[model samples]
Target: MSDIVGELARVAGAFDQPTLTLLYRGHAKVVIAMLRSAFTRDNRTISAARLHAQVDTYLDQLRIDGFTDLPSGSGRDLCLRWMRGQWLVRSVADDGAEVYTLTSHAQDALNLVTNLTRERASLSEHRIATIVNAVRRFNTEVNPDRGARVDILNSEIARLTRERDRLLQGADLTRPSADYMLEGYGELLQLVAALPSDFARVQEAFTALRTQILGSFRAEDRHAGEVIDDYLRRTDSLMTATAEGRAFEGAFTLLRDDELLLQLREDLSALLSHPMAEDILNDVDRRDLRGTVGLIRRGIDAVLAQRNRVTATLREYIQTHNTVRDRELDNTLRQLDAELARWMTSAGPRTTVALPLLPARLDVHHLRERFHNPDDDAGPPPLRDVTTQRPDGLTLADLLAQGGPSLDQLRAAVHEALASDEPLASLGRLFDALDAPLRRPVEIFGLLHLTTNMDDFVRDKEHTEVYRTLRPDGTRRDLAVPVITPGPQSPDSPVTFAEEPRGRAPRLEPA
Candidate 1:
């Protein structure tokens, strides 16, 4: 073999099988080199063949059989597969080789070691803090036995001094010069008394006693603290228990004080499930609270109904009353119209009817003469000098002495007189004073004209004629005047006959 192979084989032979396997598996190259160096020291050179044989034997003994150049299906390959499935220490063989080194089991062991280290560190910190707090608490208390011993020493010293003074006083008179021992004792006593007062020593006694009492109290306080802590612990336990569905102490007390309402509700629910109780509640007529309530409701309804009725009656009465008043007012208005019509007829232009109802408030002679004869050119038809004539001397011829007017002049006069405000009674007298042949006065007092049948006319009254003009074939024609007598006409009495051939005739009695 070559020197390099001899050197590497010798280096690999001295390594442990695990180190050799790790080298072969390509792990911790520096550690593998260091392991190889132990075997490869200058003076310790083993021959390459011997080194290979030893390494091979070690590998077999350790069952580290995978470090080889094996093809598929070789025993070495099988060993490698087994090693791959397990966690075993690994190293190199007698010759250099390469693969990944760590086994699963070795990795797990390292991780476990790391975790244990971390836990040990954490536990160290906790224990250190616990010891610190305990020491701090311990330093604050006095030593009770030491303080009591100091107090007892101080009291014994004071008692011995008093006894010495008393003994010295009693024996001094017997041997004055022989009292040196007493003097010396007194001197020592003085010197000892002169020593600084151990106030701390005295105070230590009270402090110790106080500390004892306080310690007792503190121990009690610890019990109280334990009690409080226990109470808190119990409270937490109760809360946890309740959360986990366990009953806690005093749990029912809460229900009794405040949560009793839940019980009441449950009871009420149970009551509703009972048929008799449910029926009783359902049968209660809440609508009928009291008779007074019903009565008041009924009374209010009645009052409203009465008010509506009264209002309706008042409205009807008012309407009816208004209708009656309106009808009466209408009747009064009709009567007024009729009376007005009568008064107008009496006051308007009058024809020469015989009985004139004059406005008796005026005289006749002072009336204006408005007529003029068109043919004769005479002054207004001569006014009747009847002002001087005796009322008995006026005959028809005397009345006719007044000059008359022509038809046209009379028409003018009638129209003028009608147009004026002259009363109807005056117009009648003026017509009587006229001497026109056709225009003559006729009696008209108490005339009763029948517009219906003659059977309805009243008797024993004078009558007059009324004329009407007509148009026949577009020519002006005079119609026969209607003769109205005051009495009912006999069916055969003077049946007058006049046709259109006779011209319009007056259906009047001869004057």
Candidate 2:
């Protein structure tokens, strides 16, 4: 009776889990389909806006298909609801984009749906063989007796050697039957599909650990060093302590071993190329099989990124945490709480207290004000006329030289050079040939700027050309500029300079 009651309680607890709750909810099929479509093994995360749009589209399609019983609200609202339900996690990516990722519970739910939908024999020769091989290998590795372990290894080696020799000797190859291949493929996919959730579990564990560490810090009961030490110890043990962590470690080890990875790839390729593979797997299945290594790599990256985030959190807290200020704030809050309690005890329920949020303003008998006297308000005397004074004789050319680059003049030069019958080789050559005014140092910037708005200019990064710029004072300076070559320009969009307001420089607008 006790055992039966315990089993019932365990069953109840399992049903209470988020994974089961997701499955038990209304419109589970639609929700699951949406999630599976939105997030995949390769594409684990979707930007919040993109995902919301996708959800809305999916819901629209479902409604069009005559599915009336659906979740109420917009996609964003649904996402928020799902987040609260723990199916979707809203987090900021490293690039600071808000993204939604399926929680491990949601992944488990998806995996369960995938498995249930997939067709495979419940009992198969491949399944039995896999189990037997696993058991044999487990026993061989864990056997306490050295002689027994050696004997087991020797027998396995002998068996493999005989098989290898037979294959090498041109013996007829034993081809896997389609059913056997199908079963194996099914098993492999199931294993592969579980990896995402496993990785998510590890990430969630780290996230939870980080949250706990933060709480401990906020509590201020433990010393920073002790908290750090405890964190270090937990992080060290994490990879070995949990099933997800162990799986992640195994995947990490596999990733680090280049030879092993190469071998795995070769084996997957060989399997994929098998004659039975064509019938056993579809395009999706084949693609998934081919991307096994990539999937593992992505999983490892996500786990490492999560771990790095935790490390960053620890480092940031240690660097920025102000013990003195935090203590002061904590004491202040305690004093406020004590005073509030005393007031509550003495006051009636209906009594009201009016208090100023800020300190009262200072009181003064008099604020000295300056009254406007007639003398003070009197206007200044009339200014002297400067019309009689003669100004220095300056030419328009001199004013142009002292002012900004001659963009309009530079544009005409570039247009004439480009429109010439002879091929205009480069901008530098054109600048060198230009008149003194157009060859000003500032005019070089104007030339480059004009070329940028043109259609056919290509700047050669590898080489540079010198622009011999002439100053107004007759001083010349050669500036090294990137080699800009103009390509064949389109007749329709000719580069033209347009006039602007008086003070503004003319721009090279495309015609």
Candidate 3:
């Protein structure tokens, strides 16, 4: 009982808070009044203009009844509020205006409120057949090894055939009277009422399972493998041992049983068309009778969609848990790839190449256009002068291998410059104090970045040492660069690095 109440509370939190209050007070009639006239009997869609007209009529009637302080009469805002309560769905029309449709949840809620509580139910052939079918389904599905499933099916076929033959022989079989039809519909109505409640219960089960998984995840003592094993165990239990799960399986099987559905459809269609049936069934009862098979199929689809939602959530969590491990695995594979590539390159004539060289440079856009329109540029493209090329054609790896100084060497040289007694030591001063190798733009930028990090050195921004720079096309400019100098270190704090071990991963216990 407590579990059911708890689940109810969870479901209540998911819907509009005002929904239950409004429904309890019969205010659903207000919105439903608009909905009935907003569209035709067969049509589910309502245009904004049509809906406004309905609301206008409703408000005018309210005023005639001497109602006071009513809000502005636009169905648009009212419809939007109902949408928040999951009563309606909206889409944009061709003219960029809104169109509304009644949702399945809203239909179920309205049906439950309007029909199920209106009358008392009693047993009939329909009720008896439903109970027999449900029990048989459970027996075969849950205990298939008991070995009576084939016999049950065979008996059903024989019984149906015997009835057909009796009718063919013109035997005066007792047809259901008016009272019998009403009783049968009462049973059918109860079944349809329970279907939505059944779907809600299944949804609750899925929600509870997700909560359990997430709680286990957030636990400080969680073992990842145990969490996963528990998840699989819960999934199996939900599928095999639960009534809701079995009901879903039954509905799914029914959806694929075209012969059975066709037979049921013909039977119901014939039953509802009887002149006696018309005397008992009102518009509401007729709607229920006409939509019975379709509603069951839709219920089954809802359950399956929930099942898929839970499965997708599990897949997503598994992906999230493995993200770091997958990243590490990728890094290891990339290292292996680099090793293989380097081995291949060293085995050939070129030992200096860092990455594989292309036969020609790639221009992605030009290539795409050329492939699509091969003859568009019939003439050959132009070339540039060879004098534009630089002399330093060696790869960075080749330069490193040939014993040139690295970033650490440059930083150490700058550190020595910062230890001096000058107020501002320019790059020229550093170059004079320590040997600055063939000054390239790369080396200059590297030293400038290194100067930012020295323990007691900072940039003197008010001054700059200008350098004459030459561009690739032979253009020149005077570029201003920062000069570094030693500054007083702060008395209070010093930077320190901490070392901690990566903890052991969680493991699963043996079953």
Candidate 4:
């Protein structure tokens, strides 16, 4: 068994490293000796020719399987083939030729076999002993028939009860509708957003009060009343504000004069005024100091309950969505990673060959024709784009200006470096640091687009005005104002806005 394991290891190693090819070839002689020794107990002499024939037959059989073909000259293959060639009766060579003798190589093989075989047998015995001990202990201690049937029947009954309930509920049961609950959640969110720098401060204070209430049920927590009062006062002040300080009758608004959330509050107020609950709602004052507190508290509780249910539903939805999305993304990423790994392992593309362009040089005006619809319906077939860049005609400065070097170009550079005896590892490291293929900048402006934004200027205190140089000579400057035109529009098109700009100079070009 040890001998077989060693042979399997030697064969597996051959595919892992090219350098180990010749080393395993020398291990054959000992294997053949071990085989001969195993068969030597038979009282018969094995002829060399017959022995060689037997080994050849074994080798033929191995070839039929997936094992690599062994060379006739390889000592290891010779020994293995000879061992398999033997008929039922075993025999040995003496002169290490046909005298049923073992060679020094065969002795070494036997030593390895002895150690491994002993280790394997010891492990097997230990495993069997452990299994037997466990079985005996369990059998002695456990009464398999003791109340098991009752317990099993109870478990089955419970399982069946649950399954029946599930069937009655229907496997495709949907959630309670979002129509009645969304307004409450939205109001809570809006209320949180309307607070000063420490948004949700009142909510946090109330949460602490609730925690304290739970901890000391009977104790007079006077601080809880103070906390709730402070929160109520702040919420009341926010709900009554209006344009030009005119007294308002709503909670809040995101738009002019009337807040959209105030409408939601009114709608909910109406919904809660049903025939069953009208008496409770009617007693509460619409703008009374204490009445607002009760309304806010009730709203907060309703929103909290709705949130808990929605959050659980959202979690289930997200978990199912992510499972499918993650599987697809993982498969795609693996394929991309494999392609990239392969490129790293093998010889990369050569880019020295000059890429000839079409008769007309590509420009922005011709971009649509060159890239999108390059030919008419009956026109000649479009020219296929080539991977190689024109390197010979262009100067180094021009090449550097044209987005540095491509992967193909860099690969060509590596080939050149190799011929000059430069380090390939260092070259590889430089390429590895580069951004991935699609993320790499394909245009000059794309590289520049990443560097600046209006927000950057706004955030910088030093700059009074932000402007862009129109020419390399720096003769002219254009006031940098972001403009978005309504409807489908282009950069060159006139800009328009639904409302007039507030308080700022007309820096943007007029529509």
Candidate 5:
């Protein structure tokens, strides 16, 4: 169970150092936006000069935004800082200009940041229905041997189909409450946020494979040819046989189908235009829903493309090694021929000249027997570390104190009340922190309930909380708190308000 929990944790962990810094470090968002913009449309590689210009333009805008202390060359410095953190990879371009690409780490970091900043979303029956149906379709196409899918389909098909018919007929189609609609929107957005992370995770796997291949080539004890052969074999199995790989490949295949794209676009248009949805769907939500399927498909394509890029690298390595070996074999043969000619000239013709066969390069498919890194605790498609970021702030306490309290008045009251030398403090202290009108019967009860829940509050028979009130005549009267224990087994009756005649205040009693 511990191992399972650790595995799940490892899968979710994708935020790297650059991602963490970008969130809190000033101007980091501008720098990231610049990078994203540079690559967003068509370009994957950005030249130093062009990127610098883009960053400088961004910084200039920052200055116009009234940020005066923005340092000079900070844009370039920021880019380099990302490089140092392994967020960006720099290499010389064909024209000798330095070019940069977002490393898998950088992509993962960006995805992580986006997910982190996303608004809290709720899952709902409608969203769950749509998502589950899509997943079921995927499972049928990708993993047909699974047992429960068909059963689920049989169970939901009639109900869902009838609902769709009613929606199309515009007959008795009622709009869901705002809360329900908002929840559905949030659930959809959460899935959208998660899709990019999945892409980044796959990209990271491709990177890990590339790293392994490079490591194998550089290792002193292993033959490079054998290492590569084994690497290729393992890679194929990883892509085809592993669960993560299968999910990605299934998604890739599904998305790559032109028919599916067309159908998805149509379905989204139809769903959004439906009379039932019209009330709930706003322009932004509609646009997002319309584009979400396409965006997800694009992300999956990018991830698969990363795998192809890594495989291409492996092919290049193999081709280079083969070419080099062929050259060396030719040289060895020519030297042998020279020796044979010399022997013939000195001691007459010999019956035969012996030749040694060159050591063979292993076949690509059968290279599974090569050395794997000893440190790896091999699992499905064996991978290495997930991303981790060094948190900001000077100490653990500082790090923990990351956000503001929910209510300022309540916060101050709780703090000072907790610090008081008195074992028992008046609940009115909290109510006094706010307007008298704000401290209604419900509010006073809420404050009393909060004190009982806090560990700092000492509760005993002697500490039966009492409230003091000063009258217009300057005499004091006491009021008794009905409940003292934390969330009660039987909550008190609801307070009812009654209309009062002319000048008297409204009376309240439990109903």
Candidate 6:
């Protein structure tokens, strides 16, 4: 009786697991359908806002379909409720977007419903063969007696060699029936479907481990080094100690082996192309089979990403952890808690006490140093009478000589030269004909600038032009500039120049 009771209790405990509870709930079908639709092998996560809107749309459609026994509230509220139920997990993704992912329990529930809904043979030659082959392989690897293991391997090799010889001899190939193909495809898909939940388990394990480590860090109950050592040890054992970890390690090995991966792809392609495949499998089945390798790769990437996050968390904590400050804060919090407990014991529910939100200000009487003084603020002694001081006077021509180029005069000279029937051979000839003021060194720059903007000018790279510039002190200096030749202007858009300044040169500087 006790043994039966113990077995019953074990079964009950299994049913109580979140994975089972999810299926046992009132809206199990609706929830499972939603999860399967939202999360797929290729897409494992959805941004929070997108998922909320999707859920709302799903609920709205369900209501329109007359399924009124549905959960109330908006999609966001439903998601939060699902999160509390451990069916949906809300986490910040690597890109810092808040995303929703199906928890391992939720994935398991979905997988179960999928298996149940899909039509599959309960028993088949393919299924039996798979079991037998698995058992034979397991025995060959694990058999304690070396002689037995070697004998098993030899037998397998001999059988395969005989089959290969027969195939090479042009023996007629035996084709599998549609039913057999269907059964095999079903088994393959079932295995493929389970991979997501398996990967999710490993990811959840790492996340839980990280959460525990963070708690330990906050508590400071153990030395940081000891905690880190424990973390490293667990992490190293993680890939070997648990079933999911072992599966991940196997998948990781498969990923590393290029030849094996290629062979897998070839085999899947061959299976998909079989004559029976068309009748046995549908488009969805074909897609799932074709994407098996991609699914495994994604799963491995997700697990590795989760592991990296844990490592980063540990590293960041180690780099920023301040033992002295943490200890001081811990002590202060403990003292505060003790005082609060004592006060609570002596106080009634209605009793109240006035307390300032911040610490009281210091009652300072005086400060010796002053930031400002009235004596220093006195106006400066009446401005010095600089009117009595005589300064040298300057004329407008002196200022213009010291200023920039006379652009108007230079522009008119170039336009006149280009517009004339006998245009100047080079800008140097025009410069020589210009008035003294327009031949200033600065005016040479102005002519070059205007020439660059006109279509009627071409620079002669082989030659140089010298301009005689008159200095403010009445001295002449020859300056060499690049030679520019004026060409004929098109009649359609003739070059127009501003009239030369008629009055004295204008002062360019402020007084």
Question: What CA root-mean-square deviation does each model show from the true structure?
Answer: 69.2, 18.6, 29.0, 41.6, 27.0, 22.1
Against the reference, the lDDT scores of all candidates come to 0.38, 0.85, 0.62, 0.39, 0.61, 0.81
Candidates in order, TM-scores: namely 0.10, 0.66, 0.41, 0.15, 0.47, 0.65
From the highest lDDT down, the ranking of the candidates is 2, 6, 3, 5, 4, 1
Q: In model 3, which residue pairs have backbone atoms overlapping below 3 Å?
A: none
For residues 1-511, what per-residue lDDT tens digits would candidate 1 score against the true structure? 5699888887777453432344345333332322233232121233434434543444454345454432234333433543564422233333554322333233333333323432122234334555775664454344357766667567668987987888888855333232332232223223222111121122123323333433443244343345345434533443233321132123323434434645545654553454343223332111211122233234334333433443354334333434456568879999999987877776756633355587557656777678775777755676677766668666776564343423445544544443445433332243444444424322111011111122322222244433322121233222223332224344355422221122222243323
lDDT of 4 by residue, 1-511 (tens): 3699889898887544322222244544433433544433221245656655655666666667766734554433464443443212223333456443332233333334433432122234334555786675565457477586566557668987988899798775434234223333233333332222121232223333434433442243334345346434533443223231122122223223344546656765664553433332233222322233333444344334433433354334333433455568879999998987776776557624355676765566533435445355567779887748545676665545445424344434333433443333331132334334312223212212221221111122222222232232234433333421112224354322222223333232211
Q: Clashes in each model (backbone N, CA, C under 3 Å)? A: 12, 0, 0, 12, 1, 0
lDDT of 5 by residue, 384-409 (tens): 56545555545754432333322445
Deviation (Å) of 467 in candidate 1: 99
Residue 486 in candidate 4 has what lDDT?
A: 16
Tens digits of lDDT, candidate 2, 1-511 = 3699889999999999889999999878888999999997678889999999999999999898998999999999999989988999999987999999999999999999999999989999999999999999999989999999999999999999999999999999898778888999999999988888888899998888778878877775776578678767866776776676777787688688988889989999999998888888999988888998888788888899888888788778878877778779989999999999999998999998898999999999998798768998789999999977856787787888888877768877888887778888898899899888788888877877777655567777767888888899999888888788987677676666434332222322211
Error of 4 at 328 (Å): 97
Error of 5 at 414 (Å): 76
Considering lDDT, which of the candidate structures 4 and 5 is the better prediction for this target? 5
Clashing pairs in 5: 230-367
lDDT of candidate 4 at residue 476, scale 0 to 100: 40
